[model samples]
Target: MNKRAIIIGAGVAGPILALQLKKIGFESEIFESRSEGNTREGAFLGFTPNGLNVLKEFIDLDMLQEDCTPGSIKFFNSKGKQIAKLDTAYQKQRYGVETFQLKRANLNKYARIAATNAGIKIWYDKKFVRYHEANEQVTAYFADGTTASADIMIGCDGMFSEVRNQLFKEVSAIQYTKLISTGGYAKIPELSKPLDSIRMTFGKRGFFAYSVSNNGEVWWFNNYFREQQPKPHEIEKTLKTEIQDHLASVHKNDDPLFSKIIKNSHEIIAYPIYDVPKLLHWYKGRVCLIGDAAHGISPHIGQGASLALEDTVVIAELLKSHKDYETAFRIFQSERQARVEKVIKSARKVGNTKTKTNPIAAWFRDRFIGFFIGKQIQQLDWIYGWTYSNKNSH
Candidate 1:
């Protein structure tokens, strides 16, 4: 009999992991804490070439494109002058895919649909509270006091995973990067023309980004610096006008586009940026972790969705190649640790650049930033150049 797996969380990572496992002859069920599957409250996400290629395993690109937009990228300074742009033609020609992006909710919808089409069942409202290791199976307890057992359990829960907390006695895996990310869907009424790509700006105080679709719809995000971590209420508070006014101040000297985009947003979503340092362990016995549950790199580099998809493909591949779960789990950690940590490191460096508030530091960054952005596209080759298979994930 094939070993059954229990996947926790029905977010992007959980559904993709389920489909990948099915491709490898393993069966699994996804348990999500939310009452239902899809919603439109979250922000947008970008999947680089490497990530999109892996997702192509079970999803059709055309089907996904219907929900989200895929395009190239251009970077600029606060003055609306172009700094450096990704050679999209070169990226597509070389990597077999370009940057594809959509809202987080839409991406989850697509992944869940794909998983369902492949015959994977998703249980809603099954909040994973904790787990217990048994002689031959692991039992997962949900918030409703219900339980389920499987030969293996994988946590795709997220950065603040309860599963991860249970695995380790103390909780030091997630570290705050001292940044608050905010974004929303809007209509850039003043935008003279539609854009088929992402436009990023590095200002003296914050990092601002926006993408305008061909039909005049806009999806934009901002990363602002906050010296200390916020309280739970602050993170959950809804203060659109207040946040927009603050953004107006931060982007006061930036292009009028920045302030206009902020004012245009119908609603704003906000969250903290955090990263998971390399863990001492990824799995033990019949339980393992994947996706953000294992690594939560900051989104500065736009690889969060892609890296999670890569994790699904690799874990499924490892299971197919190994005879037992023990070997599979061990190899999974060894193979994934190095690549993901590199992404985290790169994101940290770029993210810190957005937090520069000193006059001298801002001057130094703005003057020399072109050099860094020039090097950025070259470094992306290493990131978007990756290709994986169930036969050999590397």
Candidate 2:
């Protein structure tokens, strides 16, 4: 029971996995490529019941919910006409936890704190270069010329994972979905009333979404079609003014509030979205992939973070019950691949709805979207209601 493991990337998956592994007699060391205090890239994300249940095992739900807004979503057409709504309160009644939205930085901070407090070591600035698996052990090589070996190695390094690349050299590259998302927080006093729902719009030129937290901060984002994939450096070098201008123009015709939110936002970040192709295998020898490293989904479904959290629980549970690491890794992939692929496919379909559409199609969508949303909610019972303990029950 004194096995040691190496987890790459201290993102949502790594820290939670470390904590879960610790509970089952496994010592884990997490290695993150970025240096400490560098978790300021992404905007906010949603936490569904499935993901929250996993976090609740080690972290306080109230602490995670603090400063977050209710995740109930309201949809609208270009003219600002309400189209549909998701009753998250009903979801809470069904799943035992309500959905909420919070900044990515806050979740990262809390997760790392929980892992470290539980005595798990996290090594920052240790970019994983490659790993060598032999004879029941895996040795992870870092870009900093340091090496760490463990009985098992897990990749939580995310979409462009070096671990996944090294694991399957012949696999196809991650696919760019040709969509650019930009968002930031803004202080809009007049619009700061807690709406208890994220307002989403199918704008004339793009898709926009916004919500107000109890703390009076307006959290918002927009998605637009980008035919060519943006370069990493290009996204990094893009100025806040440029993003603000672009968003202001895109959402100009939809709602005045959308433009106001953009004008007031001091900081804006933009990045092109990418999707990971299906893998034939998620594990090899003593090393394995989990979370985004294994399957990356679009943000349209709001299941990306939640799915990653679910992976941590499933893998940890399997590793504890299985006799060998190889068996556990195989079962983990088998148990997860189909469900994750279903989610990835559904997310892609949802993302497609956000893209540019003809006026006729948009008109039909505005009217019928409510019915479709209601059906989707009924279909999502399996996702929100799922739990690691009931894996076999399903």
Candidate 3:
């Protein structure tokens, strides 16, 4: 009998993993919580060189390139003073691939197409409720009262994963970083010049990042005011106050694009930054966790999406090369755990700077970051330089 795998959650990792498994001659079925074919609620995501390189094997790079903005990252202070600029193109020269800033909905659509082209069956509205693994087969139960059994189960079901909770009695608690993030995409009615660079401004109150995403939409995120919880529909309800306060404290004056983007945003999403402490083991028996479920890195380094992309390819490769699931699972954790832990730590350190509780600490943190901008970017070379080879490079 042919090997069959069932994946929960059809987000970045799940669908990408499905395609990779199909290439390795394994059959896969993806169960997603949302309804089919609707990739709305647009958001922007940056694909570092490492992410783009791995994804190129499964999908067309040209299609992805067609919908991305290739640019360098510019860092600045609260007074609109330039700090240090970093070259994203360095990844291309070092790794033979370029980083891209794309819209989240566009990337999701492309990954879905890749999975479908690989003949993977994806069922929508099949929210994962529970699962059971026997000696030979693993059975997954869904909230829709449907059940499917496969040889192995992989849960790519994002940060709040049902599969991870069902398998482990105590799920690793997500630590609240106290920082609230507000982001939305909108058209640039006018620009001082044609936007071609990504900019990040660090202020006393918080930080703001802006970049042009695919389809000529400007995507911006403001992170500040460590808070307990967000109000229901907080993005729409509190965006005006939040953006105004952020601008008032930082710039002390209104700018055209910032004001227009925040006021005119049709869909704004607000969420607190939560991270799971690194887990020692990512798999048990015939089941394994991937993406945010396995390791929820803070978005400070902008590596969450890239990490998910890496997890999908790594998990698929591990399953193909190892005969025994036990050995494969252990090796997978061993090989990836250190690298992921390092990234999680880096992201946490970065997020911590934005949330410095003490005034003195905040000053020191800002100066520290400004001083080491180049060194920090260089440290990421190990991550952006990684490649998936037929043989284990580690």
Instruction: Please name the candidate that would achieve the greatest TM-score relative to the true structure.
Output: 2
Q: Please report the candidate that would top lDDT against the real structure.
A: 2
Q: Can you rank all candidates by TM-score, best first?
A: 2, 1, 3
Residue 89, candidate 2: alpha-carbon lDDT? 88
Q: At residue 352, what lDDT does model 3 achieve? A: 68
Prediction 1 TM-score vs. true: 0.92
Per-residue lDDT value at 235 in model 2: 77
For candidate 2, report its TM-score.
0.95
TM-score (C-alpha, index-matched) for candidate 3: 0.89
TM agreement with the true structure for every prediction:
0.92, 0.95, 0.89
lDDT of each: 0.79, 0.86, 0.75
Model 1 agreement with the true structure over 208-294: per-residue lDDT tens digits: 878775556777888766677877776667445557788989988878778887887776877788867567998878888887888
Which runs in model 2 stand beyond 4 Å of their true positions? Answer: 239-242, 390-394
Q: Tens digit of lDDT per residue, candidate 2, span 1-394?
A: 5999999999889999999899889999999999997978567888888998888877888887778988888998887788899878897778778889988888888999999999999999998998887777899999989999999999999888999999997884888888867788889768868777989888887788989888888888877566778776767775446668878997777779889998988667676789888889999898889988899888887898899999998898888888688989888888898899988888888788777568998889888989998998889888898787735622
Which pairs clash (backbone N, Cα, C closer than 3 Å) in model 2?
Answer: none
Cα distance off (Å), candidate 2, residue 22: 1.1
Name the Cα RMSD for model 2: 1.9
lDDT of 3 by residue, 170-280 (tens): 766777777766677667566323356788776545566777655666777776564555655765587546755565455334244465766666666566778775676
- lDDT-based ranking: 2, 1, 3
